[model samples]
Target: MEGAPPAKKMKTERQFDFSKCARRKVALMFAYLGWDYDGLVVQADSDNTIEEYIFHALEKTKLIESREACGWTRCGRTDKGVSAFRQVASLIVRSNLKEGPGVFWPEGTNAANWKETTQEIDFCQALNGVLPKEVRVLAWSVVPEDFSARFNCTQRVYKYFFARGQLNVDAMIAGSRLLIGEHDFRNFCRIDKNKARLETSYVRTIVNVTLEPSKWSCDTASGSSAYDMLELTVVGSSFLWHQIRCIVAVLLAIGSGRESPEVISQLLDINTHPRRPQYGMASETPLCLFDCSYDGVNLEWTWQPRALNATIVHLQKIWVDLQTKANMVRRMLGDLEELPGASGDSNGMTDYLYCGPPAKNYIPLLQRPTCDGLEDKREKRNAKQNGAPQTLLTESL
Candidate 1:
């Protein structure tokens, strides 16, 4: 055995030469179940991000040379545990067409006989083949090279789904109506000191907000109809980080009779409440980026029938698995409620939907401890950037 020659290693598949292919700018519409992901964006400390997986698929499929060289932009950045149905992103990538509008052919390529109606690469299929089942590339559209997914988006829609367990839906709806129109939302968002200055405007326009019954039905046999799902849809031009979650938290508080509908108006009055009250946001698991609208872009997304059907089938399977588990839990709850001393009340269920544990004693919103003002946060950030001592900065604050 020691004298035998070393066995030859099998040949690896040759990597595609992207330099020889034509390139074009494209917008991709994709969806993902984000519960298991770190977040939508790639981070330095973790590889479990939606964008990281997306770029990996692109590279594996030879669709893009590299993420750095690709002119990448996303319409929205969802937080950890959030999901998306119609999230969009744009980038320049290798194309199959040798000559066409927005296409860049390799040098010295003869394009005299190139047809204007030549077919392009099946981007959705290509990416989906390599991407995980939780993520799906729905469709792709060839766009102008100048198009930017983030900047060109005209509107964004978010949906938060929750159980209607003893919640006052009417009061919640009243509070949501107050959120319509432009308002300073500093009190309802987590300010990122690194990206925002003290003078940064938090004014954002909310076109509409609505509450409706979700399509997903509860198991009637398990007596779970009382916990029917409800959907809160928020439409806006843009939003600050954690704005939707914060708003939901407040609305849920109102629904639970802990705050009045007037609290919304009070928060919107920046002069009255400049600093945000220290309160937990709603859970991110129920939040979703529903849609991103680009009004005049004329993005005619192309979809392959086979790929579309495959995506549908995969999603159906996931729904069946989740729904079955939910039903089992509901049945257990129903059985527990049948106990002799059990009370059927579920008034406290909403408390569990909040990100942090509920306080033992409820404090009114205005009376609660408030976060530092934007100016103070900016000053502290600047001091830290200048390498000031932590103790000195704390004393200064």
Candidate 2:
């Protein structure tokens, strides 16, 4: 202890003075591998959210003075273990330009020659420098002050990936086609009684739904396409909670011949089936928020070459790492299958995507137990909030 050298002091980095810089409302295009994050939203109970990391990076880089003052808005909120390729958010951030669209200069600044100014701050590079590698800011554009990332979004596209393990692609396609127009999707979503009113509309417009071969190829060393990847692409104006996962669950049932494609239409018929039948939603790991489109907003994304190159490199590293692990697992599986008297037929669908344990005697969807209808759920929630006697409501029922 006596011979130990004096402990080194941690250097304190100086904070940036945001008051000296101009501020502008900018829209950021970003992506995240959300497997490790709690979710995209910041929660009071957890600090491991994607948005938490993002706001931390923004503040650390002095992109904004504070999260509260930044007026941040996100395009969509992704659940835990879900990923996004082209998620967008708009926020007011510090800027270098003295005069430009959405730019707010500090009081008493010289209003002279703005065209001769230096280029704006490279937001992608700045944020990526401090943010986790899983999350990357791809590009940014100056937007009008009133522009909203959520409200102005014209369309949201989601993609769910799955293996072709004994699934009837044609049947799944037919079922998905039934979801491509406006309909009451109450039966296909988890209702949040705390937030939704009894009279809240369950209607949503789906622009398109298509199933296609995945761009990512599968390993074919065994000369079997059973494990070939496929993608279910859904484009819509908006979605309800757990809607995509529920839809995929029903499609999985139809693809496996457990239910007919007409089951979709039956679920959509709220007049006949007012309550949602109890069914497990599909796994969330393979779901992705593929893209968000803003038709009315004029957003010209500016990508810095260095930032773009860094992002590509980072993504390549992730791909190589995951692919290597996957290949190793596949090799192990093949070796196990070659053993003496090994049954080569395993339930691949259950192995890849979880939709609940297999029922020994599968019950039809219409014959299953159902959840409380909207009005009943609302009454229960209201009773709880109003501190009314639960027994009285039960007696009335």
Candidate 3:
């Protein structure tokens, strides 16, 4: 004992029995318009949402009994009324779905009715048929077990649209530059009591944030207040609740000269006390998650033209119907009010007349305490491991 060296402890590693494992790994690229649903995540007994459609397809395909059972995780949690052009979700299923070339379940319900038909159908085709028009399952891949749609993401790009009205575009883009780097964004996001479980580092880096004109001619569209569209794109590794909207509000303020570009720089500085600035959060209706990327992961995906094409056809019919109604309304109100200007405002000043004055500070749209206690403990452990400073807003002390 006096001269002997101590032995190094061996770490235990997890081993899976492939033969015994019934779980089939899967990843999906889905697109959805958040206007109708409550949110993406499924809440039992809650109304229909994107996750609900996914789980329904899973159970119908005999994939998993429940989302929890499937161990599903998503790339982002877009707010209600928001949308996603390319969102990803990963999960495991129990079936022939992962086997090469022949996975099928017949039409109609099963004997138990806990699931749908046992007919022969490709996994993607079956799910698309049952899903709603606003939501679509575009592609899928069977990824390694370690792959996480959320944790493994390299970059997430989001776009927000605002009607230009009287705001200045050049000023907005200038303010956005101040946010390009690592910073503690406590001021921009909602302080989630349960965030300790999801993220240890509140200091996420924003790779880029840019503002550009919408595809529609702002000059032509500005003649009608209802048609003007201004777009902002944000790219980052991760974002907290309400962060993007809050930042948009800040930029809008600066564009209108209600707040200076220096305000954004001040907010980025940790020493700036009263972290939350009083500012307006942009409207949620126009925000969309354009894409989410994972580096070095080779994923196979396919488009469902049959389902998507049908949806497009149906949308066109609806659009034509709406156009008729709009024309009638226009005829009824002919020359009643002054036509809007080319810059999206009646008077072309850099003032946001309808949006009101900018706040000296920022506040989240909603704030609530997390119900889960386990998440609180996780946050503390992560913070300590990551060497991040603790704060009142963070669950970890």
Which candidate has the top score in TM-score?
Answer: 1
Residue 34 in candidate 2, Cα distance off native in Å: 0.5
What's the lDDT for all of these models?
A: 0.88, 0.87, 0.66
**lDDT for 395 (candidate 2):** 20
Using lDDT as the measure, what is the rank order of every candidate, best first? 1, 2, 3
Q: What is the lDDT of residue 176 in candidate 1?
A: 98
Q: By TM-score, how accurate is candidate 2?
A: 0.91
TM-score of decoy 3? 0.70
Specify the highest-lDDT model's number.
Answer: 1
- State the lDDT of candidate 1 residue by residue for 95-139, as single tens digits: 778867778865654455354547788888889999999999999
Model 3: per-residue lDDT, tens digit, 1-397?
8989898889886542233223456688888878778778777667677787778877665556566756788998887677897899988665532233322233331323223434323556667677777777777777887788999888999998765656667788888988999988876765554644255556889999877778853544214544356678899988988888778877766776666777787767656333354444676766899999988887777555675576567567766786788567655544444456423233422233224554445343223222223334455557877999744443321
TM-score list, all predictions: 0.92, 0.91, 0.70
Error of 2 at 50 (Å): 0.2
How displaced is residue 305 in candidate 3, in Å?
3.2
